[model samples]
Every structure is written in C-alpha cells, then in structure tokens.
Target: MTFVKNVPTQPQILAWLNHVKLFEGLTQDALMPIIENANYMDLKQGDMISYEGMPLSSCFLVLSGQVEVYRNTYLGEEKIFGIFSCYDLVAIAAVFMPHNRFPMTIRAKIDCSVLFLEKNSLLLVCKNNPIIMQRLLISFSAKLYELINNIDWLTSSSAEQRLGAYFLSLSSKQGSQFILPISRGQLATKLGMRYETLSRLISSWRKQKIIAIEGNKVMILNVTYLDELTLPSQRAF
Candidate 1:
C-alpha cells in the first residue's frame, strides 16, 4: 500500500463524484468538503485492502483496477464474495453497522487506486441533505439486490451450467470479445469449482468449438449453444 500524494483538484473530485450514482444529485460545492477529507491510496497486486474482522470506519471507492472481496471458510478456504472494479464503492453498509467490522478480506486483483472517505464525514453530509440520503438508500438497496443475485447464482446448478452462464455474462459485459482479468485459479475459486474442473470445462468448451481461447482472451464462437445450457430451475431468472 502506498499513500497517494497530489490529490485531485476540487473540480476533478467533483467530476468523479458526479459519475458515482450514489452522488447523482450532489452539487460540486456539496462534494468539496468530502473530497477535502478524502485519502487516496495506490495498491499493487496481492495487497490486502482490508482484512476480515477489522473495524471499519471508511468507505472505499475504486478509482481503477479491481478488488476481490472474500471470506475464509471453516476449513480455511477462501470463498470469493465479489469482485469490485472501477467506480465501485465498497463497505458502505459495514461502515454504519454498530459492530462495524469488515466481514470479508479485500485484496487488490491488480494495481489499483482507491479513494477513502471517513464514515463520519459522509454521514454528516447526508444527515441534513435529503438528496444525498436518498442516494445512499438507493445505493444500499442496489447492493442488497446484488447480494441476493449472487446467492441465487451460487446455488442454481452444476458447475458446467454456472460456467456457461458466467461466460455469457462476461461476453455481454465486455462486448463479446475480451480477455479475462483474473487468473483461471481465481476464477475457479470464485465460481465454487475446483481448479482442475474449471480447466476441464474450458477444454471441453474449446473442443466443442463453442469458444476460442488464446491465453486469457476468449472469443465466443457459439453464443446460442452457451445459452442453451441454462438449467430448468434457472430459466425463470
């Protein structure tokens, strides 16, 4: 972890805050105070952004790159909860909880920069600002929905079915042709599948000519084929 100096100018900070949906209606002047109290940090790959059970007092905004949020199971195995990328805000709920401790360990997936804002500073701003409070409520609701979606995806079906759905989602997200940002092992763990199982699934897909893989980059050759893999129970969603 490296502290970032030369913080962005007020205008730059305001521009960024404006782009964040949570601050949708906040004015430049309204955001200036929060920006003034913000601390920026640069993190390299493998750096731990936050540790499980650590007391939380700040909310983090990803300036660039990605962070993997995960928890350790009873057997000490890592269970990835989410991957946060650029412009994503994390730990907002934890910051306001009475217990106020991190439930998962957060680690940088690659070199990244993040803006940290003190919880109290943000709460103070929101207290008297109905617009900001509404925004926070909207953001909180979005996160809650996402959490439920993740739980559904995890227990939906077989690894093969899940993998197929994941690939389709990625293709849709990155415009049908994009390189995977994370390693195969990390992805395997994220999808709740064994590393070997993931490799075998990829191999099978490749053999079937459903996708073309060159290193980390994958091109979908058969989108319809992939979509047909949806399980009966998953069809409604």
Candidate 2:
C-alpha cells in the first residue's frame, strides 16, 4: 500500500468527485472543501482497506480498480458481499449508522486508487449541505437493494443455478464479454459454494458451449441457455 500525500489539483479532484454517485449534483463550491482535505492512497492487491468492527476514522471512494467487501463466518470462511469499482464509495453507511464501526472487511480487490475523507470533516460538510446527506441516503438505499439480490445466490439449489444468476447479473451490468472483477475463490464465496464446486460448474457449462472462459475473462456463448437455468421457479432466495 502506498500513501500518496500529494493531493491532486482542484480541477482534477472536481472531475473525480463529480463522477461519484454521492456527490453527483454537488456544485464546485460545495465540493471544494472535500477535495482540499481528501487524502489519496494507492493500494496494492490484498491490502486491507478497512477491518470489520474497526472504528470509523474515515470513508473511502474508489477512483480506480476494485475493492472487496466481505465478512467471515464462525468456521473462518469468507463471505464476499460485493466488489466495488470506479466511482464507487465504500462505507458510506458506516459513517452515518448508529454504531460507528465498519460492518465488513474491505480489501483491495486489485491495485486501486482511493480517496480517504476523515469522518469529522465529512460530517461538517454534510451538516452545511443537506443535499450531501440526501445523496448519501440514496447510495445507502441502493446498497440495501444489492444485499437483497445476493440472497438468491445463497439459496440456489445447484451450483449451476448460482453461477447462472451471477453471470446474468454481470451481463446486465457490464456487456456480455466483460472480465470477472474478483478472483474465482472470492466468486465462489459470494455464491456460497466451494471453489471446486464453482470450477466444476464452469467446466460443465463450457462442455455444453454455454460459456467460453479464458483465464479470468468469461464470455457467455448462449445467453438464452443461461437464462433458462435461472428461471424464477428455480431460484431459492
């Protein structure tokens, strides 16, 4: 992990902040304070961005690459909640929640650039601008909906069904040929399956020509066939 103390120019910071959902409609004047006070950090893959139950000193915004938010079960299995990419903010809910502690373990999914904003400075800005508060609420609401969607994968009857749903969701968000954001091991945990189970399902899909996989890159060969596997009746959660 690299601590980048040199701050970006106001114009550069303005461009970056404008892309974030939480600051979508914020004016240049409204965003000045945040940009001026923000600390930039470039994290290497596997670096811990935040730990579960740690005091909320600051919140992060992903400028590039990805971050993984996850938690561990009593048996020490990691349960990946989500992979956050560019223009995404991490731990927005923690900043405003009654309990001021991180809810999940956050790590750099890949080498990433992130902006760190101290909690006190953020709160001061929000107090002066109700719009910022409203934007944050909207962001937190979207996160809640995402968590609801994840429930379906947890209750899938077969690994194939889980993989199909995951692929469909990705295809919907990105194009049909986008690369996997997280590693296969993390993907298995997100789908509540063993790594071997995920690999076997992918292999079976390949045999049927449903998908073509090259390293971490996956291309859906038959979207219709994948759709059939994720019928509403077949979904458990």
Candidate 3:
C-alpha cells in the first residue's frame, strides 16, 4: 500500500468525485472543500486497508478496482462480507456511528485507488448542504438493507442456493459470461462454504450443463436451471 504524497489537483479530484453517488448533485462550490481535503492512496492486491475496530476518521470512495470486506472466523478462516468496486463508498455508516470504528477488515482484492474523505470535512459539508445529507441517508439506508438481506441469505439459504445467488448477481452485472473477480477459495469463503464443497457443486453444475467454468471464467449455460437452485420464494421474476 502506498500513500499518495503529491495531492491530486482540484479538477482531478472533482473528476473522480463526480462519479460518486453521494456527491451526485452537489455543485463545484459545495464540493470544493472536500476536494481540497481529500487524500489519495494506491493499494496493491492483498494490501490491508483497515482492520476490525480500527478508528474511523475517514471513509473511502473506490476510484478503481475492488476491495473485500471480511472477518476472521473462530477457526481462523476468513468469512467474506462483500466485495466493493468503483464508485462504491466504504465505511460511510461507520463514520456516523456512535463508536466511529470499522466493524470489519477491508483489503484490496486487486490493485486499486481510493479517495479518503475525512469525517470532519464530510460533516461540515453536509451541515451547509442538506442535499448531501439527504444523499448520505439514502446511501446509509441502502447499506442497512443490504446487510439485512445478507444475514437472511447466510442463515437461511443452502450452500448451493447461496452460490447460485452469487453467480446470478455477477451475471446481472457482467452478462452471462465473465471472469470471477476473486479466486475459487475466496469465492468459497464469500458464499460461506468449504472450498471442496464449492468445487463439487460447480463440477456438478458443469456436468448438468447448468454452467461452464474454465479456470476463473464462468459461463452460465442455463440461467433458468441456476435460478431454480436458489430459494423459490426469493427468486425474482
């Protein structure tokens, strides 16, 4: 991980900030302060961004690449929470929480760049701009909803169901064919299954012609069949 010593120019910062949903409608003047105070960092794959319980003085906006949110299990295995990519805000909720500390560890899934917005700077900006505050609330609420859905998924879904839902989500974003963003081991952890179990399920799916996998790339051969693997009640039309 490398901290960027030379600060980005106002225009450079504005270009990246423009894509962030939190600052969607704010004018140049409203965002100038944040742009001025923002810090940039470059992280290599596997670099630790923060650990669980780390002080949350700032939040990050992913300018490029992916980051994983995860925690260690009692057996010293990693259990992934989520993977976030470009334009995604990391730890926004923690910045506003009473404890103001990260609840999970975050690390770079690939080489990435992130812009850090100090909590104090953000709050000051939100004070004068109600629009920013409203956007923050919307982002926070969406994150909360996602957390609840994830809890339900992990607790109630079968391993195959969980893996199917994960594939479907990737297919939605990258069409029926795309490379897996993380390795099979990491994917297993993300879906809350043992590596051998995940491999067996994928092999079974391949044999059944439900999907095809070539190394890291996956092709969904039968979307319908894969969809059926998920909970019937939760399946989307």
Candidate 4:
C-alpha cells in the first residue's frame, strides 16, 4: 500500500487503464464499467497501499512513478519482490485468487499515482462484460505462464546466466543500449543478491570485457555469451 501524493483526474485514470498492455484486450466500450466501479486513491511518497497479511480488498493500477513489493525475514532484511513502473498493475495475484491475501508489504519506491478497484466491483464488471471477462481469463492464464518463467530465474541459475538475463530484459525496452529503470537496490532484490555484492559483480563483468557500463547504459559486447550465461543447458526461455 505505498504510493505518491498526486490525485489523478478521470482523464488521467482512463489514460492509465488504456496504457496498460493487459487491458489492451478490452475495447473502449468494454472498459467503461470497470472504470465506473474503480475508485481513485492518492498516497504520499512513503504511504503504504496494502500491508503484508492483509485481506485483498482492491487491485491497484499504476498511473505514474513506481512501487516496491518487499518482505522482511527473520533477520529483518527487506527482500524486494519487485519494482513496478507506470502502466503496470499491482496486486495482480490477489485480484484473481479468492484464497489470497497480500503476501508482502507494498511501498512507494518513489512518488507515484495509482488507482484502486474493489474486488466485488471488479467481479461485477467481469460478469457483466463478456469481452472483459474473456480477456481477463486469457490474461490470467498468460500471467501464470510468465510467473513460472520468473520462478526459473530464482530457483536455479548461474551468476553469468542471471546477469545475462538482466541485460536481455533491459534490451527488450529498445536499442542496443538502454537505461535500467529500477534502482541498484531493487535490481539486487530481483536478482537475489546483496546490493553491494551486485554492484561489485557488475564491475567485475565490465573488467572481464563482457559488457560496457556507462551509468545505466549497458552495452553487451557479446550477445552470444550473454544468452549462454543466462539460459541454462537444458532450458531456454
């Protein structure tokens, strides 16, 4: 339940819902009811939207800025689950799972704008709008598939492979060089490493002539090697 302090106008909320790729399946006509049922909630920079272990009440759609999902373990270290940017949906799992409660604490990684949709209202939208319902089902299925792929990176991997995967994910944005959107600490959370350790590893990769790093720009010197490093022997993602 973290967010920025900006209150969004109706046009802004519509723009956000339209921008999100998952909602692309809905026509302008089809998206109206969901919009009608949705509520616009604003939060300050350090505000929490949903706490760990809370009942899943509303799903959030990011209108601007970023959010971090993290969990604290026995040692009190906060392990980030992920950092989501504009047009991304948060509380995705909770939206579809009746058995689900929020599993982690969500905080604004930076100042952000977000919209909240209550569960029953969301359900009514789906039930009444067949087009949205169909899209939601398909989108949920695709989400599950993507989650399995994400688990692959976490459960098993070599150092080289993880770094390669990181660069590849960045490369998907545009061009041979792109700025990483997330911070070093958030990247460490996704990569399952300490922040300082991840920084050293990136430096080591540069020294090894694997890639050229300038600020957030990482130029892959050898895509072949990077692909080899990130993908496992028996699996290709």
Candidate 5:
C-alpha cells in the first residue's frame, strides 16, 4: 500500500465527490470540510485495507479498481461478503456504529486507489448538515435491504439457481457478453459454493451450450435456458 503525499485539490475532490451517491446533491461549500480532511492512497492486490474490529478512524471512497469485504468463518475459511468498485463508499456505516469498528476485513481485490475521509471530520460536517445525515441513512437502509435479500437468496436457492441469478444480474448490467470481473475462485466464494461445485456447474452449462467461457470471459449462448435455471419449477426436469 502507498500513501499519497500530496492531497487532492479541492476541484479534483469535488469532481469525485459529486459522483458519490451519499453526496449527490450537496453543494461545493457543504463538501469543503470532507474534501479538506480526505487523503489518497494506492493499494496493490491482496493488500489488507482494514481488519475486523479495526477502529473506525476513517472511511474509504473507491476511486478505481475493486475491494473485497470478507470474514473468516469459525472453520477458518474466508467468505466474501461483497465487492465495492469505483464511486462506492466503503465502511461509511461503521462510522455511525455504536462500536465504531469494522465488521469485516477489507482488501484490495486488484490494484486500487481510494480517498480516505476522516471520521471526525465527517461527523462534524454531518452534524451541521442534516441533508448529508439523511443521505447517509438512506444509503445504509438500501444496503441493509440488499443484505437481507442476499441472505434469503443464498439460504433458499440451489447452487445452480444461485449461479444463474448471479450471471443474470451481471448480464443486466453488462449485456450477454462481459468478462467476469474477479477470478472464478473469488466468484465461487462470493456465491457461497465450493470451487469444484461451481466449476462442475459451469462445465455442464458449457457442454449444453447454455454459456461459453473463454478464459475469464463468459458469453451467454442460451439466455432462456440460463434464466430457467434460476426458477425452481423449471429445473425439475
């Protein structure tokens, strides 16, 4: 990990802050305190950004690349919780938590850059700016709902169904053909399945011409069949 010695200029900071959902409609004046307190850093792949129970000194704004949020199970295996990409703020909710500590470990999935926004600065700004506080609440609520949905999906859905739903969700954003952003191993962990199970399912899909995989790229050859895999009744046969 490399800490940037020079802080970003106000204009540069404002440009990036404007893209963040939590600061979407805030004016330049309203964002000054945050911009002043933020610093930049670069992380190489596998660099640990924060560990579970780490003090919430600051939160991160992803400027580029991706970060993985994961926790170690009692059995000592890593379970990926989520991936955050550009413009996503990581661990902002932890700032308001009673314990003010990270709940999971965060690491660079690939080489990445992030803006570190100081927690005290953020809280002070939010105290005087109710709009910012409101936006934070909204972002936290949305994330909570997404987490609940994921719990339901992971526990109730079959492995094939889970993979299909994941692929379909990616396809919606990137069309029928797009590179898998992370490695297959990472994908398997994110989907809550063993690596062998995921590989076998993908292999079966390949032979059936449901999807084609070339390296990390996936092309959906049979969109309808792939979609049907996500439906319990349709997969009975």
Candidate 6:
C-alpha cells in the first residue's frame, strides 16, 4: 500500500487527537473524568484487539497509526469494512448496540496506541462534560450520515460510477492521490465482489482513462467525471 505521510510519535499523535473536534475547547480536567479511567495500550502489528464474538465495553480512540476493521463475509471470505487512522474513533457501535459485541474484528496494521475507556468511565465522562458530549453527538450523527451517503453511492448509474465513487472516498481521506490501504482481495471484499471482478473493472477504468493505478497510489485523472457520477440527478425536467 502507498504509505500515509509519516505521522508524529505516539505521544505527539495522542496529544493531537486529544485536541481534535470532539475534544476541542475541552480542558484536560473536562476530559479527566473519562481519561482517568482510560488505559493507554500499545499494540503489536497484526495483533487482533477485539474479535467478532467477544463482548466489548470501552471504545478505542486510535491515537496513533492505522487499523483495519474486517470480518468474514457471507461468502466465507475475509472482508474489510474500512481503514481507520489517527483521531478515528473505534468500537463505537458496540458501545451503543443491543448485544454489545463487536460486529467486526479490529486488527493493527502497524504498531498502534489506543486509549481504552471503561463503560462506566465513559458514562461518567458524558455525565460530567456536557459541552464535549454535545460535540460527540454531532460526531456520531455525522457517522450515520456517512453510512447513508455510502448507500446512495452504491446505487450508481453504472459499474464505472460505483468504482469512481470508491476512489472519491479514498481521495477525500488521502488527498488528491489516494493510497489504498488494503490488498486487491480485501478491496474486493469492501466492494462486495470477487477479486477478479474488481480487477476487470479496474482494467476497464484504466482503458477509459478514468484513473491510473501505479501500485497502491491511485491518481484521479478526471474528477469531473467521478463527481458527476457521485452527484445524483437534480430532478431536471
């Protein structure tokens, strides 16, 4: 995979995350309620943090490095849901879901540092920090919006439109040139198709001059076309 711009050290990255959107304008004492009960854990590469069946409590904030959320698809093949990086909140659904079990497994793509807060501790944090809590509600709502947007993207006019929508998501995160975080197989899983199908689609895309893939770096040659695909019809008569 094409590498992300090297982020700072773990502690520095942690500090950065602590100052992010949800935590912004919030003093350490304001977060002290949750931070006090939170434990900072280091993970070795390829280590699995939470498995599918086990119950989960505390949510993880990826303070440093990248992580993969994946599980076995209905087809019995490993499927990647997404890649999470610094400042990304993990295990959110389990914290609020009915069963309280992680729907997917979390694996470290590289050495990682995550802040874990216990259930009671998180509740206390919310109880104490109303301002930060408001911001969190906004953040959670934004996640729901993102999922809804994904649904819209899936209902593309054509196969190329679907592929274009996918690259747009990556570019939004990684800048103009998107570096895919997973292999061809895992990407196929994310796209809900076989590897060969995705390969053929990419081949056709290259032929159509929509995108150019050299290794993991996917250069968007025509954003106009991709954007047009993503933006639905305006109900013009």
For all predicted structures, in order, the TM-scores are 0.86, 0.84, 0.89, 0.76, 0.89, 0.81
Candidate 3, residues 118-141: lDDT per residue as tens digits? Answer: 888888888989987788788778
Those runs of model 1 whose alpha carbons end farther than 4 Å from true positions after fitting are: 74-77, 231-237
Steric collisions counted per model? 0, 0, 0, 8, 0, 0
Q: Which of candidates 3 and 4 is the stronger one according to TM-score? A: 3
Q: Model 6, 55-140: lDDT tens per residue? A: 87787788788889889977787888877888787876577678878888888988887766677666676678798578778888
Error of 3 at 211 (Å): 1.5
Q: What shift in Å separates residue 231 of candidate 3 from its native position after superposition? A: 5.3
- The digit string of per-residue lDDT tens for model 1 on 1-237 reads 999778677777777777788787788667766888888899999999889899888888998999888887676667777788898888877877888898889999889988888888788777767887777788788778877876786796789888888888788789678778667877888788898999999999899999999999999998888778854424343
Off by over 4 Å in 3: 231-237
Per-residue lDDT over 79-156 for candidate 2, one digit per residue giving the tens place of the 0 to 100 score: 888788898888877888788999999999889999887787778779889988887777778767766665754574
Local error of candidate 3 at 110, Å? 1.8
What tens digits encode model 5's per-residue C-alpha lDDT throughout 129-210?
8988888788778778777777877898888988898888889899999888777877888788999999999999999999
Model 6 misplaced stretches (Cα beyond 4 Å): 1-17, 233-237
> Per-prediction RMSD in angstroms?
2.5, 3.1, 2.2, 3.8, 3.4, 5.5
At residue 70, candidate 4 shows an lDDT of 84
lDDT of 4 by residue, 145-213 (tens): 787877866678755567678788778676668777666766776677777878888888889888888
Ranking by lDDT: 5, 3, 2, 1, 6, 4
Q: Would you list the clashing residue pairs of candidate 3?
A: none
What is the overall TM-score of model 1 with all chains considered together? 0.86
